[model samples]
Target: MTQQIRRVLVRSFEDIVIERVPAPVAQDDELLVRTTVVGVCGSDTHAAAGHHPFIDLPYRPGHEAVGVVVATGRGVGDFAPGDRVIVEPNLYCGRCPQCRSGRYNICQELKVFGCQTPGALADLFTIPARRVHRVPDGMTDLQAVLVEPLATPVHAVAKAGDLTGRTVAVLGAGPIGLLTVVAARHAGAARIAVTELLESKRARALRLGADVALPAGAPDLVDRAHEALGGPVDVVFDCVARGQSMAQATDMVAKGGHIVVVGVGAAGTTPVRLDLVQDREIRIEGTLMYTAEDYRTAMSLIASGAVDTAELVTATFPLEDAAMAFSASLDLEQVKVLVTADGAVGVDGR
Candidate 1:
C-alpha cells in the first residue's frame, strides 16, 4: 500500500485545492522532508493566478519552506531523520554551460522545485540531500522558512559590488525590498531609502532600518531620495520591477552607479531607456534566484539575528487554508503569509 499525504495544488487560475497524493519516496541521495512551515511568495500568488510565465497550471506552489528529515534514501550520509532543515529550491544540471562557469543559478536547463516541478507544500516531500541545509539549533521553523526568500536579497546585494559607505535606494517595500534594506545596512551602507505604494509598508521600511521611506507615486520621489542620500544613490535596487519602477531606477541611480533588477514584473517585460544607460554609463544588472553561497550567507545572517525574519511574517494559516493564505498574501498591507502543516512546530504555539 502506498502512503498518502495532503498537498496544495493549483488547479486553475485563482483556484486552489488540498488534495491527498501519494507520499514521494526519497531516491538514493535524497531525503524525505515532512513539511513544517511554507511561506507564500509573490511568485506563488502570481503562479496561482496564471501570471507566472514559467509555471504551468495544476502545480504545487511552494519553495520557501522548512521541514524535518523523516527519512534518508540509500547513499545519503550528511543528513539523518529528525534534523530540521531549510530547502534550497533551485535544481540545476551541473553539466550546463552556466553551471560549469560557476553560474548555476542561470543554468541552461535550470528547474526550480516549486515552479517547474513538484514542491514542498505537501506533508511529505522528497528532495536531493544536497538541496537541504540543516537549520541551526534554537531557530524556530517560522524563522527557518524565511531563509529561502532572504537569500534572494543576499544575492541581489552581493551583485551590487562593494557597498561600504555607499548610499542605496530600494524601490518597493515588499518582503524582498524590505529585506534588501536590511542587507544594505548589513553591508555598511551609509544611507538607505525605500519607495513604497502602501503607507504601512513605508512605516515597516523605516522600522527595518531605511533612512527614508517615500511613496512610489510621489512626483519628486527620485529627487527626494537623492536629497535624503546626500546625493544620487550609489546603487538603486528595483524590487518592484514594474516598468515605471525600472524607469525610476534609471533616473534615481547616480551616474556610473549600478541598478539591480530584483523583482519580476507582472507583464514580464519592461521598456527601458537605453539612451540613459549609454549616456551615463550606468551598469544595469539582472538577478535571479539565489546561489548556494547566498543560501549559506542568509542562514548565517538569520542565525546571528542580523535579519529579522519573524517580523516579516504577518499571518499564518494551516495547510487546509492555503487558499485563504494565498488570498491574504494579495493584500498589500501583509508582508509574508505562511501555511503550516498539522502539528507543525513554531516559535509560538503550534
Candidate 2:
C-alpha cells in the first residue's frame, strides 16, 4: 500500500490549498526528509499573490526548511536516519560554465527546488543528499529555519566586497533587508542605514543593528539617508528592487560604489538615470540564490549567536493550516511566518 502526505499548493492569487498526495521514497543519492518546519518566504507570498517574476502558480511552496532524515539512498554516507538537516534548495547543472567557476547559483540550467520544482511543503519529501546540510547539535529549529534565507543575504553582502569601516544603505526592512543589516554588521560595515514603509519594521531594523532607520516613503529619504550616514554610502543593498528604491539607491550611493540588487521585483522595465550611471561609474550587480559556502557561513553565524532568529519569526501554523500561514506572512507587520508538520514543535513554541 502506498503512503500519503499533505502538500501546500498555490493555485492563484491569494488562493492556497492543501492536498493529499502519494509520499515519495529516497532514490539513488537522495534522502527522504520528514519536514519539521518550513518558512513562508516573501517570494512565496509574492507568488501566491501573482507578483513573483519567476515562480508560477499551482506549485508547492517551501524552500527554507528544517527537517529530520528518515531514510538515505544508495551511495549516501554522510547522513543517516534521525539526522537533523536544512535544505539548500538551489538545483543547478554541474556542467554549466557558472557551476564550473563555483557560481552555481546562476547556472545556465538553474532550477530552485521550491520555486521551480516540487519542494518540501509536504509531510515527507525526497531530495538529493548533496542539497542537504547537517544542522549543528546546539542549533534550535528556529535558528536552522533561517539558515537558507540568511544565506541569500550573506551571498549578497559578499558581492559588496570589503565593507570594513564603510557606510551602507539597505532599501527595505522586511526579512531579507533586516538580515542584510545583520550580514553587513557581521562584515564590519562601519555604519548601516535602512528604509522601510512601516514604522515598526524600521524599529526592528534598528534593533537588528542598523545605525539609522528612516521611512522609505519620505520625500527626502535620499537626503536623510546621506545625512544619517554622514555622507554618500559606499554601498547600497537594494532589498526592495522597485523603481523608487532603485532611484533612492542611485541618489544615495557614493561615486563608483556598488548597488547590489537583492530583491525580486515584478516583471517589467524600470527606469534608471543613465546619465548618472555613466558619470558616476556606479556598478549594479544582480544576485541570485547562494552556494554551499554561503550556507555554511550562515549556519555558523546562527550557531554563534550572531543572528536573532527568534525575533524574525513572528508566527507559526500546523501543516494543515499552511494557507493560514501564508495569509499571516502577507501582513505588513509580520516579518517571518512558518508552518510545522504534525507532531513537530518549534523552539519556544512559536
- Could you tell me the lDDT of residue 55 within candidate 1? 82
Per-residue error (Å), model 1, residue 201 = 0.7
Number of clashes recorded per candidate: 0, 0
Candidate 1 Cα outliers beyond 4 Å, as residue runs: 343-350
Candidate 1: tens digits of C-alpha lDDT, residues 1-350: 55667778887646798777667788999999999999999998888888887787878887998988998999888789999989999899999889998889998898999888888887888999988889988888877888888899999999998999999999999999998988888888889999999999999999889998999999988889988999887999999888899889999988899999999877655799999999999999999989889988888888888777656999999998999999999988999999998633232111
The 10 consecutive residues of candidate 1 with the worst lDDT sum are 341-350
Q: Write the per-residue lDDT of candidate 2 for residues 145-226, one digit (tens) a residue.
A: 9999899999999999999999999999989999999999999999999999999999999998999899999999989998
Best by TM-score: 2
Q: RMSD in Å for candidate 2, one decimal?
A: 3.6
